[model samples]
Each structure stands twice: as structure tokens, then as C-alpha cells.
Target: MSALAKQTITEQEFQGFAVTDFPASKRLKVVTLDEATIRAFNDAVSEWTVQGIEYKPFLRFEVADRLDAITNYTLGKFLNATVRDRATGAFLLNYQGSPNVEEGDARTEFEVKLSTAVSHIIGLSNHDAMYGQYYARFTVRNVDDSDSYLRKAHRRMELHNDGTYVNERTDYVLMQKLKEENMQGGDSLMLHLDDWAELDKFYKHPLAKKDIVWGAPKSKNVESKVEHPVFFEEDADGKPLMLYIDQFAEPSNKAEGKYLYEMGESLEADANFLSVPMPVGSMMVMHNHFWLHGRDKFVPHPDLCRELLRQRGHFTE
Candidate 1:
């Protein structure tokens, strides 16, 4: 458990939303938008289609402003504060009740817009090479042929930071569950760097600062390789900030290989990580450097299907 107390939020300070600590961890905040807020947000941005916002980047900020306006501009301020603080750099955003919208793709569009709004309020998402857009939407099924474990349903995707193979600074990650069916397990896994007991051991090691090659699989759609150390940088308070992934790190020599391998193992074995189950229409946003995110494996079912939307980018100072 974190030393920080669960943040207390009252309706008096805002409208149509509530904040609480996630039951499993104090490091994450659970933000619930009341139906009234959702209705207002839907009505406010009803004029703009998802494609229009995608095509016109400024409109995305408009969408975010409309939602933040519902709470008298407190939602955006709260969200930004939560994600930037190292002690509480993550949030699970979900509505208290059903959103005022029709079922099917219409609702999916609302979800996408909602995520876009949330993401833009904090920072703009990087161009997702995998999806050829600012955000990536993909599905996982019982059987698949993919170059990475991203779409595989049976095995756990070990906990690691994203943007390890890319040159861009992925300061944050936003993942929303657009839809799912016949799904069991597959909760998101998250770990704060400060919570890992072995963090100091690795961060203080000599190899931690050495440049290591990182690359992506064929499905990632990136042909080039990048170089960076596992602990590539530091936070404001000098805490270690990581950029690493077990599968993508191409260590150059025996020392580099073992260092990377052992770091992955140590991260996987940590006990402080949180397993968060995101309901449909819910999103999880985290500071990419301090928080490592992954997915748990799904149970086998012939008709299992899960669709997810992902946005990763750096903070705009």
C-alpha cells in the first residue's frame, strides 16, 4: 500500500463526478462521472462525429472543454493533477451509470470521443504507427496470428513500460475497453516504479544507463530500431523512470542481455502491482514512465472477443 491517503473529493467542489481510491491500490484514483455529466457531455459534442474530431485536431480539445465545462472546469484540473503526481499517476475513468446513448457502434463512437477528450485534456497522443492514427483500436480473439503478444488471448503480457521501441516520448497511456464478449480474466496489470522493491538495485546498476537497442515486431509497422537504456531518465524528485519491454529489448552483449532479462523477471515478480478490471466504456490512463502496464491472459472460449482502444503520448508542458 502507498503511504499516500485516498484523495477525498466532494460534489461541492464539482458537478456530475466523484473521485475515490481504487479498492486494490491507493496509487490509482477511480473517477466516476454521473449520468447527468455524461448526458451533458454527449449533448455538448453531439454535433461533432468521431471522424470529424479525428480529422480536425482542435475539435478534440473542444470536446474535452465541453466535458470539463460540465464540472465548472474541475474535471480537467483534477485529471491532470492525478496523472502528473508520481505518488498518484494513474486513474480508472468510468461512469456511475449508463451513458445516454443508443447501443452498438453509436456507443462505441461516444467511448472513442470520450477517450480522445480525456487524452487531449492532459496531452496529445503520439501517432500510433500500429493503427496509422493517433489512437489504435484492435481486437483479441481465441485464435490469432499476430507478430506480438498484444492480440494473443491465452498468455499473460508481462508488465513493462511502453514506447520502449519508439523514439518518441510516450509520457502517458490511455486504454479504453470499447467492447467485449465471452471474456474472462484479462484484467490490466499496473506497477508503480516506487513500489517495486528491486527498483533501486537495477536503477543503480552500471548497465542501467548504457544505450541498448530496441525494436518492434512486424505487426508494430515500424522498420527502424531505437537505442535507450532501461532507466532512460529521472523524474522531478530523481526517482528512476523506465522505458522497457521484455520482448522488444535487443540487448547487444551478454551483460546487456542478462540485465534486460533480469529486469523483466524482477518486474514480473513484484507483489505491489494492481490488477484492474476495466468495464466496457471505461478507460485507464497512467504516467508511462512511472507506471508499467500490461494485460492478464483471458480464459479460452470458442467465441471470445475483446476490443480495445489505446492512446500513448507525451505530456505537453
Candidate 2:
């Protein structure tokens, strides 16, 4: 059990947010901020535009502090505690009512700023190689000629962790839906390591700790191949920490190949995985090692377009 499992707090502690279990998964905490709280946050940070926040990194923390201050600092403490707890290291944060922002570019810019503030409250986001920025915003259109499975709309992206091929410490991953049009059947998929039925079968395997080569495709813009074990390390309690991705891993031999192949198959077939539907302006944040995330296939349409914002980074003490 995680430390959070034993910790208790009164309901009155959180002023304008309601905490509840997600429909399909009890482990995930759904935090919905009230309209008043959202308005207060937006109003407090209205002066710091996205450009200003980007230019001054310290200002990002100020933005986070302002948002947290609205809840008397209870929201930040609760969020950090929930994310650090192994038993429940994930949360879906969405406001009860929409902010007073215009549609189109203006709304998208506000979404980016809001996500940035939330991320800074927990930790600093790593520079995204794909976008050359602290956060990445990309769209999934009806036609995609991308090299990897990321932008492909017709097939599932597969269960995997982020920062597999990169050297950065990706402690957490935040994915927010910005816009969607003519979309269906593209729910986010998540599988907790502890909930995976076959975790022990693979974790105890010989190749679990063996170094495997990983390389990204052209679109990723990462030229070199990095090496790491599937079970990269253990947590403070000595539990396994996984870092595996099906697409980028380059198994050198038949044994390694077989091991990875079986692991992927096991993950896909696991019944404990959660299929989460993210509405516009909602974001899902999870511990990178303990949680494996993916995307379901999208319904085909000539004008299908879904814009998403992503940030992967390490936690700050």
C-alpha cells in the first residue's frame, strides 16, 4: 500500500474542488475545480501571458502559486500527495465550468498557460525534443504521414511510457486535450504497473534488467540510440520501476525480441487497463514509471482533427 492510503484529510480542507474516483478506476482521483476557483485562478494570472511565462521560468512557479493560493494552498498539497503516493499516483484535473476565454487561438493559448501553471506546481517540465519547447502541442488530422504511431489515427498507439529514448528524467506525464473535431473512439488508455496481472512474470525474467537499445524515428528528431533496462530501478520501497516502449526499443537478439514481444502482448491483453475519455480542457497526469499510457484508434474521417498538448518532466523536491 502507498503512504497516501493511510493518510486522511477532512472533506472541508479542499475549498472549491471535489475529489472522487474515476468511473472505471478507483485508484485514479478525479479532481474537479469549481467555477469560482477557476475564475479566481484565471483572473489572478491574467497579467502573465504565455510569452511572459516562457521568457521567465521563475514566473511559472508564481503562476502555480497563485492558482494554488485560491484554495488556501490545499489543492497543491493534495495534488502532490496524491501523485507521490504509489497506490494512487494519477489524477484527472478538470474545471466544473469553462473559463471566460474566446474560442480558437485565444482559447488554445489559455489552455497552454493553464497547463503550464499546473505542471509547475508539481515540477518543471522537460524540453520536448519533438517540439523544441517545454510543452508540445500537436494535432491529429485525418491524414498523417508521420514516421511513428503517434499521429496515426487509424490504430491504437500501444501502451508505453514517455522519455524512453531520451536521457531526461520523466517523472510525470501531463496530457491535455485542446481541440477535437469529427472524432470518435480515441479514448486515452492507462495501465498501472501493480494492476498488470503479468507484472511478476516479466519483472522476474532475466532480460528485465538487461540493457536494451532504444532509438527514435526521424520525426522525433532524436538521432542517437540510448540503452536502459525494462525495469530501470526500484522506488523507495524497492518496487519495480518500468521504462519500456514497444516502438523505439531495438532488441539485439531473439531472446530480447521475444521478451519484449511477449511483454507488449501481455499489456495489451490485460483487462485491468483503464480507458479514459478526456474532454476539451481536461488533462490527465500520471507517474511515468508506474503508469503505462496510450491512445485508442480514432474514427476515420476526411476532416478529422484533434489537437493535444503534452508535457513530460521530473518532480521537484
Candidate 3:
């Protein structure tokens, strides 16, 4: 059995889902919910509309509890443990069958709620300034004019950590795929800090602990900049906690610039990163600090479009 499999209660079989190691990396657990769990969850939450859940903040946790209850609460416990463990701090959640809802707005609403339940299971999602909600839904197309690489489809998004510019401590990031169209080559990319071959080479460097400026573009709705080093803090066991992005860092001098440059170059060149293809209604939640994530560029197609939902926030426990 894998290390992550050892931590889970239901390895071979569970109440509503089954757990397995991702093919690319053992650090990521793949949780596939049975069809019954999907139908039962839909029926349970049918009484509450997406609008109603949004109006009542606490209803989100109620939805989370309802789903967990269907699985005998084992799913929640396993997911919490998986994310908190540095040895395995991520999971890919996808269902086996379709629910009662049809495609379009109804389907999107169902997915939003599904992601919400998953998000609250481990942590509460922060209000997204860009989308003006607890969860943000955005689309990517062949042609793009976005200020950041988030919506661009032609080029690869370099590996980096989230919450670099935000004041809040973003402990987790949840990314879900809502829709896809003519999309050929857009897969989610991930890498653990310990897996990076040059981690120690950069961690011991002087600039690794020096404060660097980080700022987002106007599209992100974050006007203020924050200051922090690449290795901002450490875990209880003294492991490094990182917050960085190649596009957002602002170095004032040559030394700072070179340090940031080499770090980005090393991360991009690392061969240990995992490239995951996210199917519709599938979501991946990861510990934001130790795990670096990005997206592989999509194949050029005029009609290509992919809708995605994102929720990033700190862990509750």
C-alpha cells in the first residue's frame, strides 16, 4: 500500500467513494465518488437553491455535512488528513456518473454547489475579489487579452504558489473544471517542494529569506502589494513554506532579480512535476504552500473554450 493509502480509513472500499493513488504521483490521492453518492447528495441539497446557499453563509457547511453524512463522515476525515499531511497534501475528486441535472446553467449551479461542499469540507473559501463571490467562475478561450496568464490559452502558465499577494494566509486551493469545448491540451500541472531537485540549493541562499514585493494585475482586483520572502515561514518540523509567482514578483536590484529569476527557471525545468488532466465536474484541492501548481498551454483552436471554478482559502483546523 502507498503512504497515502495507509492514512485513509477506507482504502479498498468506502461508503460512497474509493481512494487510489494518482498515476503520476503518490502524493496526490484520487477520490472517485460512487454514482449513489452523487444522486443522494443532489437529492439532499435539492431543497436549497444555489442562491439560498449563497444568501446564508452557514448553509455551505450544512451542505458539506450532508455530503459527509452520506459517506458515514469518512470522506471528510480522510480528506482533512490527506491535505494536512505534508507527505500527501492534495487530492483529485471526481464522480463516476452524472446527476439529475442537465447541461448549461443548471449543471453549472450543481457543480458550484459540489465544489462548495468540497471546499467547506476542509476549509472555507475566501471571497474572490475578481468574481465577487466565495467561488469564482472563469472561462478560457483561444484568443485572450487578460492582464494575467490566468485566461490566456496559448502559453504555459509557469509553476507558482497562490496567495502570494493577498494578506490572508491561503492554506489551500481548490480548482474545478465546469465545462470544456474543443480543448485539446490544457492540463493542470503540479509539483511538491521536496520533489524539486534544487530546493535545498535555493532554500539556503540569502535571498530566500529576504522580503520581495508581490503585486497582481488590475484584473485580479488586488491593488495593494505585499512583501514577503520565498521562504516566508516553516512548519513545526522546520520544512519550508513558499509563496511565489514569476509574473507578480518585483525585485528592486540585480541580486534580488537574479535570485527570483533562477528560482523560476529551476522550478520550470524540474522533471518531477505532475501534469493532470481535469475532466468536467472534477476538482483538485491542494495545500498551497508546499505544492506549486500551473497549467499546460492549450492547443490553438478558435472555438476552444474551457470554464473553470476556483476557491482558495486557509484551513479551518
Local accuracy by lDDT, each model: 0.90, 0.90, 0.92
Tens-place lDDT per residue, model 2, 1-317, is 44443454434368778899999887799999999988888888888778888788888889889888899888888888778778888999998776787898878877888798789888999989898888988999989999899899999989999999998899999999999999998999999999999999999999999999999998887898899999999999999999999999999999999999999999999999999999999999999998999999998999999999999899996
Worst 10 residues of 1 by lDDT: 1-10
- Writing each residue's lDDT as its tens digit, candidate 3 over 169-237 gives 899999999999999998999999999999999999999999999999999998999999999999878
Q: How far is candidate 2 from the true structure (C-alpha RMSD, Å)?
A: 1.6
**Total backbone collisions for each predicted model:** 0, 0, 0
The parts of candidate 2 lying over 4 Å away from their true place are: 1-12
Candidate 1 residue lDDT tens string, 148-262: 9999999999998899888789999999999999999999999999999998899999999999999999899999999988888887777788998998988779999888888
User: For every model shown, what is its TM-score relative to the native structure?
Assistant: 0.95, 0.96, 0.96
TM-score of 2: 0.96
True-vs-predicted CA distance for residue 54, candidate 2, Å? 1.6
Ranking by TM-score: 2, 3, 1
